[model samples]
Target: MSELFPDGDEARTLARLHERLARAADRDALLDVGYRLVDSPVGPLLLAATEAGLVRVAFDGEVREDEVLQELAEQVGARVLAAPRRLDRAAAELEEYFAGRRRRFDVALDLRLARGFRRAVVEHLADIGYGRTASYSEVASLAGSPRAVRAVGTACALNPLPVVLPCHRVVRADGSLGQYAGGPERKRALLDLEQH
Candidate 1:
């Protein structure tokens, strides 16, 4: 909200607390939910959320998918249920994107976990576009902190939206593929996929 860091440090802290509140809501009365498993260039992605909004997007390696869904339900106060149809649009769009048939994301996302400098960096990443890349320093400068290259890297690692937010497009200033939440290999694959 309000681009996360429209001002300074005070705004950053407030946005962070707001995000924590969003994540902490519905701790007791976990509603009905839906889920879908979609394939991506990296691996399988599990998309789940309540009728309230999209809650979880997990990649491989987390074998405890049920637990993750339960945690999401508890966080959102919604009962978990598999509903691939509810996620049809997201699945299809992702498929198209990975297949190089689509360049931009057309899915509604709940990015409340992202805020402050992270939020600003993500917003700038979204504007990076397919087949294009930026250095961490570039992103930091865009975020109004030209000297915060390391901070920009932190923001990229904290990105919740990933491909939708285009964090893969941000690379090291030396033209190296940097770290990604999904791993650097996956990041390379994403960039390679988009290149063609």
Candidate 2:
């Protein structure tokens, strides 16, 4: 028992310290962003949120954690922390979605990473509905740029919040699964999940 408990006091102290630090950071508004990693049918997803709302969702295989954190620090703010509590709601919503119990996400979003045309395209994705897909041409038309089919694809590719924004609901005009930031397999999985 001593071998494992040789530093029991130290472990408890460390836990207490971390709790205090998190609380202080929250109290002072020093936590510009809070993030967590959650498992899903597709893969592990890195969820990030600001005081405003969920900012980014990156697939583990698509982007490295360090890179995502760096991008968040640069584009959002530097005071990022691994505050799981802050993302509890987002994680639960994702779990519900993967379980086929949730069709729509109620999470608030921060779309600062997307701008101009891209923002318009992703914002319109919500209209795509659950378990249904729309072609790039159709999405482009819906976004008020009837000829910008390619641009619609690009917008889905660079969507900041993938699953939450329902970018997987966008497909190529030929009835094919197109590119996804989380990769084609993940897009297929998400689409398939929604179908059942």
Candidate 3:
């Protein structure tokens, strides 16, 4: 046995208990939201999903784990759990993306976190294409609000799904990197990754 669990039986019992709890939750439809932490080139990322699809992706430095969970509980549902299995597909797709093996994310997305024009802006970001960029004004125009340049920036800032949605592909009119939800450095890193 390991030091933490001197008796192997205790570890096994705990594992079984957790398994039972997960099964029971699923069976009873109590698992409203499931989440897991994934390591990436930038930093640790929190991935949350619901029955509909992948919901939120948060950066560790930008948001606290507990805060993310609390927000999900309030905005989504209170039956959130550390259910890694539920987010396996999202985690794998992210891994493939960071490794440059994948250019598009096929995972279903629950964009309830954003609404109205913000949702429209983020949804349009996916069309920016891999390794290509669009100016905020261009994105605003594409999103059908030609004059809402600042609104486009706000939409990117509040995008619930960052890398997957390719919000980092949006830049300034002069081709300068702008503010990002994951910070400027991370945005630069993502752009750099795509360039190569």
Candidate 4:
């Protein structure tokens, strides 16, 4: 959590950039697609939104940013842009979370990118809560298939929303951090942030 708050001019610059991006993103409301890269304690994150609500999120090192963006355009729409306005509320909420000032997120979500069992898993993920961890089998059971533990991992790996969905709370039955889309270290970091 220590990394959440950046002091001095850097923090101020980030705030200004966020504001400017949000305004710029707001410039084209008709496009229905807005996205921005946000700085965080973990690293840079790609945040994207739609008219429906917050959509996809990608970690800087986990996924190829360009491929993810292109896929977003092909999957959601073609009018996507690096617009911060669409991401303002989500970004603010995330900042607060990293600062250990927030537990649950209150942003609208666009879940069209996920479907079927994976969608169910994502929804169940939200119930895990901050500072709490659940086993893969447990979550799989909650998703209605106790035997689908492996599938739970896959869903988490492909999770369109990470921090917002709180997939980091999922763990191995042995109480170890499993494979995370953002890698195990980040998973540990998020878990540590909450646990402490």
Candidate 5:
């Protein structure tokens, strides 16, 4: 049996515990505030979120820092800070990975932005093994929704984990590299990194 807190407080504690458990069940469900900005081959990628966890990861070409952070504040219920260290380790790993000195990411990931089918798809993508590629259809099947090819695509589009989740590993069934939220050139570069 679980240890109980002081009488009346026990019920409240149970409720809080249940809420946290529910959030854990949903990968995209987080409740924290954090921020990260890292350099990428494409340029700087800025990320921000509430304590519930990371809520935004925007490309350099897409500049909407204030609006994005403000929105994250409203959604995650916390003020946003400009702490790049939240992703510093991720940035370092990415730098090494991109430089061909690393393989896997060893950084904390705030996956609260991905939920439901999208969360499932992202999780499955994360398991796609390095240097390997899978078709959209294959990933959809792995996500337990074999016919959700389009949905899988949407999930890839929304993936916050990017290189960690390896959305670039997802390709068209016809052997064509498909569109990437980060862009095709980056996708090509990432795939080449894995291939060679």
Candidate 6:
């Protein structure tokens, strides 16, 4: 009687319900889209995936959760569900990253949200490596357009996948953190976490 939940019935009920839902989701035949909200050192992240791969990763409060899901529903398919199993590998890898156990992600990525120059920019950004910082101009040059530095900045801003692609590793020519999809402080933390 001295506890907030004295009987512990609520906890048991929730665990049982989670099991049922996980089982049911596993049984669903046409589950083309799966999503889950996972916690990160920066904040909560909304991860969504399709049969193709990890489609979107959104930071908590960066955008409304429903808006992120609705965008996925429109971009991928309408069969999205809050299924954690599908995102288990992604969650594990992200956990490893935050723990500093992983320098690179092994999860498959779906870059359908980005195409053309942005896609090229994102791909190049991934190669910038762990603890390495590349300037916008350098990224643009590597992406095959030295004069498209501004476009490179745009690409990073709209990067569908942040930590996985290492977009936070890109910085201003003066070594400033510049803009980040997950905000500047999060970017700084990721960089600091990586450099150490």
Return the TM-score for each candidate structure: 0.73, 0.91, 0.91, 0.86, 0.74, 0.87
The regions of model 5 sitting more than 4 angstroms off are 1-32, 49-56
TM-score of 1: 0.73
Query: What are the per-residue Cα lDDT tens digits for candidate 5 across 70-120?
Result: 666775655455555455565677788778888776655667778999998
The clash count of every prediction, one per candidate, is 5, 0, 0, 3, 10, 0
Candidate 5 has its poorest 10 consecutive residues by lDDT at: 22-31
TM-score of 3: 0.91
The collision pairs in model 4 are: 21-84, 22-84, 22-85
Which residue pairs collide, candidate 5? 28-112, 30-52, 31-51, 31-52, 32-50, 32-51, 32-52, 32-53, 33-50, 33-51
Best-to-worst TM-score order: 2, 3, 6, 4, 5, 1
Compared with the true structure, what per-residue lDDT tens digits does model 1 show for residues 77-137? Answer: 4556565555677778788887789999767766655678877887788778789999998
Model 5 has an lDDT value of 0.74
- The local lDDT score (0 to 100) that residue 49 gets in candidate 2 is 92
Q: Evaluate candidate 6 by giving its C-alpha RMSD to the native, one decimal.
A: 4.8
lDDT of 1: 0.74
Off by over 4 Å in 6: 1-29
- Per-residue C-alpha lDDT of model 6 across residues 5-74, encoded as one tens digit per residue: 5665888997789767765865865666788999999999999887678989999988999998888888
lDDT of each: 0.74, 0.90, 0.93, 0.89, 0.74, 0.89
Name the runs in model 4 displaced over 4 angstroms: 1-28
Query: Which of 4 and 5 is ahead in TM-score?
Result: 4
Per-residue lDDT tens digits of candidate 2, residues 47-156? 99998889999999788999999999999889988888888899999999888999998988999999999999989999999999999999998899999999998899
Most accurate candidate by lDDT: 3
